[model samples]
Target: MRTALAAGTAWLLATGLTAAGAAPAQAAPLQAAPAADAAPLLDAGSADGRRFRATGRLVGGGGTTCSATVVHAGGRPDPAAKALVLSNGHCADDTMGTNDVVTDKAAPEGWTFTPAFFHDNVAEQKTFTMERVLYATMKDIDVSLLRLNATYGDLAKLDVTPKTLADRRPAPGTALRAVHAPSDGIEDGRRHLRQSRCTATAAVPALHEHTWLWKDATRTDCLGISGGSSGGAVTTAGDTGRLVGMLNTIATPGYLGCGLGRPCEGSAEGLVVPKDDTAYVTPVDAVASCLTGSGFDLRRTGCRLDRGTQVTVTPDGRQTRSTTPDGPARWDVRITPGQGTRPTWVAVKSGPFGAVDCTRPEGYGTPRRLPAAGLEHTAVLPAQDNLHVLCVAGGPDATLQGAAWAASLAHPAYAYVRVDNTPPTVAPRIDAQHFGEGDDATYWVRPVYAPWELTGYQVKYGPRAGTDCADPAGYRPYLNIPASLKASQGPWTYCAIGSDNAGNTTAPAAFTVPSG
Candidate 1:
């Protein structure tokens, strides 16, 4: 059977099968049912929020439970180099006991995972079975990596677009989000993802924290985490969406409220003093370190060192304004190596026009030596054209896919001048919304995007109130309320259009504003 341990400062080294000691009382399972009047949606519309549904239970004998998250490595979500689920090592114990893989203990029989079960909006929970565990260990790190079964073809089709792993250490004071599905009871586990907003308190925590890339964090709000959340994800707050760490355990002064079958909403009374009483995480680098030596071929190829490298390009001066076609724009490129590395190559992508070979002189390809450190290179680009620049630097031996490289790297920088000849796609969403003024009717119009082509928005309304619905004619400048803005009153049909600087127009987004 699974064991629990009290919250303490003593380290539990992942070196061997230490005898199962007294475990902490299992926290109450999370309350998974939302109020009957609650919205039908389970997520908050954020990337990680939507992806939380993919977190599921690791079911062992007698219905023991733990949590795990699905991840797709590399920047791109689809067609990734590695896709795997990660969780605590104890979740896959072969004997249904707290066993360590470093001690040569295999995972218990019937060890399996089911994604998106319980609270999946149906009368009953439905789950898709995951395949075998590729790696599991308690020694030095409490982690388990599992592969999805072959029967589930195409992870993308399964609606399991994995999240990209975080590569860099988050700056202190950065806000973060952690999501998990905690077990509610020994009889039945909680099936919905619970989230807590936390702040990074420290970069290197104490040894008992049980991770090399340890980051001590505390919930910013009253969101308490409970049991069964082991192996869930911890991510940053911005749209860049870097995955920072994995949930391990909590160190609370006392039992927080919202336990077993209760909403894991943290309470002020439950908040403890003492620094040790908080949540702990295993950094994402641990996963990379483990997978690289596992011989599973899961090690991500391309430039690992290059992923953290920073690149920046700036216009020489006064170049921010729109320019006439075929205008000249001058810019400078700067490259800064991430952490312990430096640049090796720089390539420029001049949109809709010129091509420069990276290997040749002034290019980033090999045989061309990089300039001295802290030096800036200047380039003159055409006006009204989009430009993309890449700067790569690493040891001479680093290579990717037969391309000689000491490491892989990200695009250095991209600049746009907003010249478009093609019409923009129509905005897909337009809705009449209510914001409780009782007598004010408002409509929100979304934008149709093709990256940097948008220049202006126009809204056309009919002559009479409440009748100008969805028509293409009689359009006027919609300077009053911007897209997603709310207006006081409207009983009129409205159609919205977008334009690009290059004289291209988008199809309309139309809706009839109901009389408030």
Candidate 2:
């Protein structure tokens, strides 16, 4: 999960910050620092809290919070320039698609950051508005480089310092510490910076979490990490610690399989789910080469990050395309090439539903090469059953083969097609209720039972029985009828058809009024 620290009434009550009927105060704007008297104080015993004055609580446009840090490429930077803040890409925009890459975009309104966000000195914190998103992407990495409206000189006046980005990835077993402003477990309900002592466990070649697949991630045993910890600074342990990575996610407990909160490590052998309490960090070394004196420039010499346009694989017609066993089990999809993208290779792989790894080439057959630049190209998946995933990857050399082809592929576009001939076996049941009497009598019918795989149901009602129950065009969506419908519509006959995730539907089950 991206760890969107939620702020709600329940959290206020749990923290005893608000009384039963008292209204919470509205958050102040980030134009200036809050009054010292108006801020909450923290424990004075801990001295380590003062070290991470650059780390702060980042509030998204949607009101959710995450951790972020002020960072500079290296040595001395111009203090007059607008400061740069680093955080997870999802923090900048959680709605980013699998291959979405956002660059040089205007920051959403209401986005702010509070530096010097220590539990001990909450009163000293200053909020600043985000001016722009220099670069933000979740492709092969989860990172965002944001520019603040305030200048480094402005922050320096308040004794706020920026952490230096480490030039390389930290080796396994390196002593490390994580500093973050997490919202969970805070008795006061305030987002306060917390620190954890840990060590780098291992390097994950690829970490698969839901639709995002991150490469070269560092796994750690960091404790005290929770909601609002996304983009927390993971640095080498010391007084002058340098930033090595940023906390991205944790292995959430209770998830039985790999997905979302439960990020699985992928390798040639397959995926491995880590035990609960495990956390992962994305290395920041790649960002170093991209940073310039002004800000980030993707065209920089040594920057290996993908700056090419995104490839799109869209189905010809309906977004959801399905086929039955007896029907032609093939789909026609259009591969649209983005401007500036290189020649692309398209391939299709199929497996049991939800088993295919769209990022890997282990099970993929051969790939068909597409021209360097084209408006669109059509690719057909070889006839197969189960689920098919069509992937399109771009690279430098169009004729690259074998390992070179797999290695050169970057930020591939994917589309899915599901094939299943089995229709839902179970029938649907309806519950009917009557209210009032005689002329004022009203009847309401609701579906009470549906198959486990049911996605939705089509229902039709009239004075007579329905004909051609399988015709979905004749029915409306299955919704609870209002009690206002007159029961005098008497002897009404209702028919229901259910559709499953595989696009297969069950035969209509009918119920007659008064007789049902």
On TM-score, the leading prediction is 2
| Candidate 1 residue-wise lDDT, 341-406, digit = tens | 454544344322113222222444442333435435445544342222223333333233233342
Q: Tell me the number of clashing residue pairs for each predicted model.
A: 30, 0
What are the RMSD figures for all models against the true structure? 21.9, 9.9
Which residue pairs show backbone clashes in model 2?
none
Q: Name the Cα RMSD for model 2.
A: 9.9
Q: Model 2, which residues run further than 4 Å from truth?
A: 1-47, 238-240, 268-270, 315-333, 340-391, 395-516
lDDT for residue 485 in candidate 2, whole number 0-100: 48
Residue 54: error of model 2 in Å? 1.0
